[model samples]
Target chain A: MKMKLRNFIILIIAVTFVSGGLFAQKKLTGLEIMKKVYNRPSPKEMEAKLTMTLISSSGSKRVRTIKQFIKDFGKVEKKIMFFLAPADVRNTSFMNWSYDDPNKDDDQWIYLPALKKVKRISSDSKGDYFMGSDFTYDDLGDRNPEEDNHKILRMEKVNGLDCYVIESTPKDEDYMYSKTITWVVKDRWYGVKKDFYDEDGEYLKTLTLKKAENIKGYWIIVTVEMFNKQKNHKTIMHLSDIKIDTGIPSRMFTERMMKRGL
Target chain B: MKKRFFTLIISLILIIWFGFADGLQITGYVRNYDGVLLNDDMDFSIVQNTLDLNFSMQTSKVGFKVNPYIYQYSDKTTVFDVREAYLDLFFNSFDLRIGKQQIIWGKADGVFITDIISPKDLTEFLLRDFEEIRMGVTAVKFDYYIGDNTFELVWVPVFSATKFPEQGSIWAVTPQFPIQPQFDFSRKDIKPSIKNSEIFAKYSVFSSAIDFEIMGGYTWDADPVIHTLKQIDPFTHQLLSLTAIPEHHRLTVAGGSFSTTLGPVVIRGEGAYYWGKYFQSEDPMLKEGVVEKDYLNYLLGADFTIKGIKFSTQFIQQYILDYDNFIVNNEVNNLMTFLARKDLLSGDTLHLELFSYFGLTDEDGLIRPKISYDITDGVNILLGANIFFGDKGMFGRFNKNDMVYVKIKYSF
Candidate 1:
C-alpha cells in the first residue's frame, strides 16, 4: 500500500512538470516571438528571377522581369537586380548594400544603358515605391525587430492555420505606416498575411503570401501579392528559378558588374 | 569608301555568326524628330529620322558588341554611321577590349571637366542628348581588378576631333570681325601621326559608402585652335588671302572625382587641372595667336529625391592660372545647372523634366523643359522646348536658335 502511494505521488509530479513546460512555451512574449521571426535561418547566397505584374483599377496591366542576386556578409547584406525584359528597360541594373547598423543608410546605385554610366543614388527614404511596384523599398529588405515595438494581440487561425496575431508600431513617428498587424504561422513561423495602416489609422495596403514552398529544408515564399487600397492598384510578384546557397562571389555585386549586366 | 564597305562586310559577318550563337541579343530603336525654330519666325525647320541597331554576344570568356546608326534628313539625304564596335576578352581578374568605343569619366552633369577622352558632336550643342553627342574613338582598353579597386589603361592610336555644326546650319557660328575685311578664307586641320598617340590611365576604388577615382591622360584637345595666316595687299593695305589652320595642341590632364551619400542627398565632386590649354583672346592684336594657359576646372553637385520628385544641382568653376591682361575675360568663370524630374500616372508612364544651365559670369543661360509619355511597352513620345537667355557668350549667341520639338521612339 505504501509503494502504491509513492507511485501515485510520482505520477502527480510528472503530470505537473509536463503541463507547466507547455504553459511556459505558450507564454512567450510578443517581442521574443518577433525576434525568432526576424532571426530565422536564411541562405547565405540566393539568386532568383521575379516577374512583377502591376494591375490598375481600370484593368490595365504592365509586366516587368527582373533577375536578383543576394549575398549576406554577416552584418552587411548586398543585392543586385538586373532588368531582363521590356526592351526599353533592358540592361538597366540596380545595386544596393544594406548595413545592420540602424544609423547607416543603404547605399544604392543605378546603371542606365542609354547613359552608359553608373549613377550613385540616394537611399534616404525607405517608403518610396520600388520600380513602380506596390511594394516599398523597405518591404523588399529585411527589417530589424528592434526598429519597432511588437505586442501579441491574440491567437487566431489564419486560412485555417493556427497563427499568432502580432501588432507592430514603428518607433519613429515619421515612418510611412502607423502600424502593421501580421499573422504568423505557429509551426512554420512564416508571415502569411499583413495589414498596414496609415498615420491616420486607416487601412493603406494589404500584403499576402499567396504561396510558399519548402525546398531543401528551407521555407521560401514563392508568390506574393500586395494591394494598395488607396489607389485601388495591385502588384503580384512571382518568384521562380530560385537557387539557394549557390556561393556567389562578392565581386559580382560591384558597379562594374552592374554595368556589365551579369 | 573601301573602309565603309569593309566595316559593313565585317558587321554582316558578325551578325551572321552571332545569329547562330547561343547567347546573342539584338536590340534597337527607331526615332523621328520634328523641330521648328520658334524664335526665327518659324522659317527654320528640322525633320530627321534615325534607326539604331545594337548587337551583342557573350560567352564565358569572350564578348562582342556593335552599334550602327542610320539617319535620314528631310533633304533626301541618308547617312550610315557606326557608334561603337568592340571585342572583349575576359580573364580571371582583368579584361581587354579592342575597337571603337566610348569612354566616360567624371560625375558632373551637362558639364565637361575630366570627361575628355571621347570627342563630341556639337551639331546641336547641349540640346542633343549626351549619349548622342558622344563620338566613339578607336582604342584598346584594359581593366584589372584588385579587391574593390580597379586599374584601367586606354590607348588610342588615332586622334579624332570634335565635329562642329555645318557652315549653313542653324547652329553654326559665323566668326564676326571688327571690320569687313575682303579676303579669301581657307581652313585646315592637323591629322594624327605616330607621335600624337593618346594614352590614359586611372585608378578607382569603390567602397560601401563612397567611390573615388584618380586619373591622368596625355591627349590632344578635342577642339582645335584656329591660327590665322593673313596676306595683305601691299598697295591698298587690304587683306588679299587668309588661311585659318585648326591645330590640335597637346594637353595633359590630371584629376580625380568622388561621390558619396550624405543623409538623403548624393554629393559628387570632380576637378581636373589641364596643362597647355588654348583660350581665345578677344584683343585684335592677339586674335591671330591662340593664347596657351594652364587652367583648373571643378564641379560640385548634389541630387536628392522627395515625394517622387528628383532634384539635382551642380556648380562649376574654371580658374585660369597666371591670368593675362590681354585675355579680356575674367580669370574665373562660373556656371550652375539645375535639373528636376517627376513622374505622373500610377505606373510612372508619364514623366516631366526640366534642365537648365546658367552662366554666372556672362549672365547667359539655357532652359530645356520636356515631357515624355510611354504609349506602350516599347514606344515613347516626347515633347520639349529649348530656350536661351543673355545677349553674349555661348547661350546668348544662340538666342535665335530657340526651338520646340517632338520626338517619337519605338524600341524592340
Candidate 2:
C-alpha cells in the first residue's frame, strides 16, 4: 500500500509540473492568442502539400493532392498557386486568373482543357466550387482581420489546449455572411473551430479542425471537417506530406505557371 | 491540328506576357437556372435551362468584355444574344466604352420599371429591372463634375431599337377578327426612324447625417404620332391607319431623392414628374376616336430597415388620364399599389407582400406570403404561396391556379 501511494504521488507531481509549466510559459487570454497568430513572423513565401476530400450523399468521393505556393506582395496582391492538382484535373493542363480587389469583390477565371478556352467569372460567385474541391473561392481568398470587428467571447480548454472564442462581424452589409465565430489555440495561434452565419443572422455552417501536428517545425492542421447544418452534408480535408518554407518563387503564382503544367 | 496549336501558342504568349509585365486575366462564369413554379402546368415555359456566359479579358494595355449567352428550353433554342461587349478606355476622370451597354435615365418607379424605353423585359418588377440591358444607337456620353454634383450629356445622331428584339416575337397577339383582319406584321417594321438626343444633370450632396441626389433631363425624339384619315368609305370612313411617325417628341423630367438614417431607421424615397408632348401614348384600342395623352408613371415610396424587420410600400399610377378611356371600354388599368415586409427569425424568415391596382376600370390585386428556413449549414428550404382576388378575369394573371411553390437550395 505504501509503494502504490508513492507511485500515485509521483504521477500527480509530474502532471502538475507539466500543466503549471505551460501556464508559466505563456500567460495569454483568448484575444491575445488571436493577436499573436495574426502577427506571427514566418516566410513571406511558402509551398505546402495539400490533400482535399469531398463527400456527397450519393456515396461519391473525390480526393485531390496538390502542391500549393503562397506569396505576399504587400497590400496590392497576395498571390497563390496550385502547382499540381489544377492540371491533374482529369489529367489535363489548366490555368486560372484571380486578383485581389481593394474597393470591390475580387474576380476569378479558369481555363479548362476540354473546353479549350479561358472563362471569366464574376466576383459575386466566390462561393462556388473551386476546381471540384469543397473549398470555395471565398474560402481561398485572404481575409484581413482589420476589415472586421472582432469580439473575444471567452476561453476554454479544447483538445487539451486552451483556446479563445471570438466573433467577427463585417461592416459591409453586402458581405455574404453576417458574422463569424472562431476558436483559436492560445499557443499555436491556429484556428480550430469556426461558425458561419448567413445574412439573416442564422447559423449556416461549422468548420472544425481536428489535428494540428508539427511537421518540419510548422504547426499545421492535418484534418478539418466542415458540416453543412441544413443540408446534412459534410466535407473533410486532410493534409499529408506537408513541408513549409520551401523557398517558393513569386513567378510560380503568375499566369505562366498556371499555363505550364506543374 | 494547326488551329489547336495556334490557340495553345497564343495562350502561352498571353500568359508569359502577363507574368513578365503585369498579369493579364480572363475571367467569366456561366449562370444556369433551373426554374420551377407552383402551378407546374401554367406554362412556366418562358425560361428553362438558360445559360448566360460572361467573359472578360484584361491586360495592362486594354480591357475587353464579351458576353455570348443562350436561353434553352426542352423544345426551343435561342442563340448569340450578347448583352454587352465593349472595350473600355480609361484616362484620368473620364472613361469611354464603345459597343453594347446599358444606360439609366429615369426616376419614377414604373419609369424605373416597365416604362423604360429600352430593349428589356417588358413587365419586370422594379427591383428585378436592374438586370435589363438597354440597347440604343451608338452614343457619345460625357460626364462632367461641378463640385459634388455631376452633369451628363448623351447624343444619339441615329435611331435605335427601343423595344426588346424578342418582344414582338412571342407576344400573346389577339386572334385575327374575321371582319377586320389582324394588323399587318410588315407595316410595323416600316421605319422613318427618329434620332434621339438627351441631356441630364445630377447634384449629389453628402454630409455625415444624410445623402441626397437631385436630377433633371430633357430629351427630343424626332418620331411622333399623327392621326390621318384616308377615304376608305365616305359614309363609314373606317380610320384607315395611323401613319408611320417622323415628328418631334419633346420630354422634360425632374426628380430628387434622399437617403437618411434616424436612430435605427433608414429612410430612402424619391419622387419625379414627367411633363411634355409625346411623353405618354395611349394603347391603340379605340376604333374611331382620338386617344388622350397622360402621365407616363409617378411613384412615391419609402422603406424602413430596423432591428430585423424590413417594411416598405409604394403608391403608383400609370397613365392616370387614360384610365377614363379604358374605363369606358371596361379595360383594366395597370396602376398598382404595393406594401411588403420581411421578418427575420433565428433560423428562418417570413415575408408578406401585398399589391393592389386601382383605376376607374376595375379592382384587381395579389397577396403573397413566403417562409424560408435554414435546416443546416449551407442549405435552405423555402415555401411560398400567392393569393389572388378581385375581378377574377382582370387580375387573373396572378390567379394562375393560385400557386404554391417549394424550393430547396444548397450553396457552398
Candidate 3:
C-alpha cells in the first residue's frame, strides 16, 4: 500500500511539471496575440475628461479640452464628446455609432455651436486628419483583424519590458497604410508602440503609449502620443478623472444629450 | 439713456455671475473688424468693434445659459443685444428648455429651407456669420429621446419679424420697379399676441447608415408681401406713381431633410412646401396686384475630401406652382454654391478657403476667398475679399459694396 501511494504521488508531480513546461515553451502566432489584444476585457461604459495637445516642430502648441462618454451595447457602440474649452468651440459636440456588422457603415454627426446646427458626416473620410490633428479619423477607430495579414517577426525588449514584434499588412492595396508594426507587451496583451508606413512604403507616423493603469479591474491606457513624420507634428492625448462602469444611461448617447451637455 | 441702462444691466449680471463659487463658467471674445471698398475712391466700408460674452451654470437637474453682446460702429454708437438666455430642465428620457433661444433644423448648408423657426437678420446682406444672421426667439422647447430617435416640439408665444437693412445703408437693396414706389408702412408690423405665435415640430432618426428629420410649422411669412396700388393721372389716364403696401401673412409649411453617405461622398437634401404664400403680380385687373401661390424650395448638396482638400457643392431651386407671366419672379429660380478648402502647415495653423454663389437664373454671382492664420492659442488673424459680379439680381445689387476686410479676434 505504501509503494502504490508513492508512485501515484510521483506521477502527479511529473504531469504538473510537464504541463507547465509545455505552456511556457509554447509560441503564439502574431494573429493570435493580436486577437487577444483586440478582445481584451473592457468596461461597459466610460466617462472622462480628455485634453488634446498639438505640438509643431517649431515648438508651437495648441490645446483643446473635451468631455467624453462611451457606451457599448451588444450590437453597437456609441460615443459622444463635447468641447468644453476654447471659447470659440465651446458647446460643440460630436457623436458616433459603430456597428458590429462588417457590411454596415458607421454613423457620425457634429454639432456646430456657432450655427446651432447638427450636421451628419460620412465615415469614409477616414484618411483625413481630425480637426487638424496629426491623428486621422481612421486612427481614432478600431481596425478589424480579418482585413490584415499578420506575421510574427521577432521578440524584443521595449522600454525594459519583453514584447512581441508583429507586422500587419492590409489586404487591400489601396488602404491608407501600407503596413503597421506593433510592439505588444508580453503578457499584458496591449500594444506599447506602433509604426505606420504610407502607401509609398515610407515611414509615416508612430503612436507611442505613455501610460496605462488598471482601473476597476480593466487595464486602460490613459495617455498616448501620435507623431506624424511628414508634418513633424505630434498630438498627445491625456485622460483625466476617468470613471468606468458608472451606469451611464443609454439615452446619454443621443443627440438630445449632446445638445444638453453636462 | 437706453444704451446706458443696457450697459448697467449687463454690468450687474456680470457682477452677480462672478459671485458664484462653483460651476459658474464665463467665456467670450473681443473682435475688431474693418473693411475697405474696392472702388476707385477706396473709402472705408465698415469699421466695427464687438464684445461678446457667455455665462453658463449647470447642476444635475437644471442648467442655464446667458449670451449677450455689444457692437460699436465707427460712428461711436453702441448696440446691445441678447442672443440667447435659456433655462433647461433635464429628465430621464426628456428635456425642457424655456426662454429666448436659437433653434436650428435641416440638413442643408448655408440655406434656410426647413430652418425657419428663427427669423433671419438680413441687415448685412447674408454676409454675416450664421450665428449672427439668426435672431433668437422666446419659446419653450421640448425634446423626447428614444433609442436612435427623437421628437422635438417648439412653441413661440410672440412674433419676431425679419430685420432688413435701413434705408440708405450700404446693404439696403431697393428693388428697381417700372416706377418709383411710395411704400405704405401702415400694416408692415406684426403685433405680438398669442394668435400670431408660431409652433414647430420635428421627428428625427439617426441610424447606422442614414440620418433624417421631418418637420412642419405654422408660422408667419419670413418676409412681407408687397401689394401694389397704381396711381393714375385723371386727364391723360397715365400712370403717375406706384404705392406699395407691405403686409405679413400666415402660412403653413412642411419639410424634411436627409443625409447619407456612399463611399467617401456625403449627400444631403432638404425641401419645404409653403402653402398660401402671396406673391407680387403686375396684373392691373387685380385689386391688390398680388396672387396667392404655393411654392417649393429644395437644396441638394454633396461633400467630398481628396488629397487633403475638401470640396462641397450645393444646388438650390425655388419653384412656384401654377406659373404665370404676370408674376415678377421666374417660374423656377436656381442657385448654386461651391466651397473648397485646404488646411496647410504643421498642426494646420494656416487655412485657405474659397466659397462662391452662382445665381443661374440671373447669371449673377458672388465669390469670397479667405485666408486665416492662427497667431497663437485663442487668437486668429483673417484677411478676405468679397467680390460681386453681374448687372442686377439678388447678389448683383450689392456689387458696389464689394470690399476687402480684415478681422482680428481674441477669445478667452
Which candidate gets the maximum TM-score versus the true structure? 3
How many residue pairs of model 2 clash at the backbone? Answer: 12
What interface RMSD do all candidates show, one decimal each? Answer: 1.4, 14.5, 1.7
State residue A260's C-alpha deviation in candidate 1, in Å: 1.5
Error (Å) of candidate 2 at residue B161 is 3.7
Ranking by lDDT: 3, 1, 2
Check candidate 3 and list the clashing pairs.
none
Q: Stretches of candidate 3 above 4 Å error?
A: A1-24, B1-20
> TM-score of A-chain in each prediction?
0.88, 0.71, 0.89
Arrange candidates, best TM-score first.
Answer: 3, 1, 2
Task: Quote the positional error of residue A261 for candidate 2 in Å.
Answer: 30
- Give the 10-residue window scoring lowest on summed lDDT in candidate 2 chain B: B169-178
Best by lDDT: 3
lDDT of 2 by residue, A1-262 (tens): 0011001001001111233346547755544555554544443444455666655554555555555555544543333334233222421332222333444333233434323222222334444444444455565554556667788788888888887788988878877789989887665555777898878999987888776665444455567777767555566766656455566655454323343324
- Shift of residue B237 alpha carbon in model 1, Å: 7.0
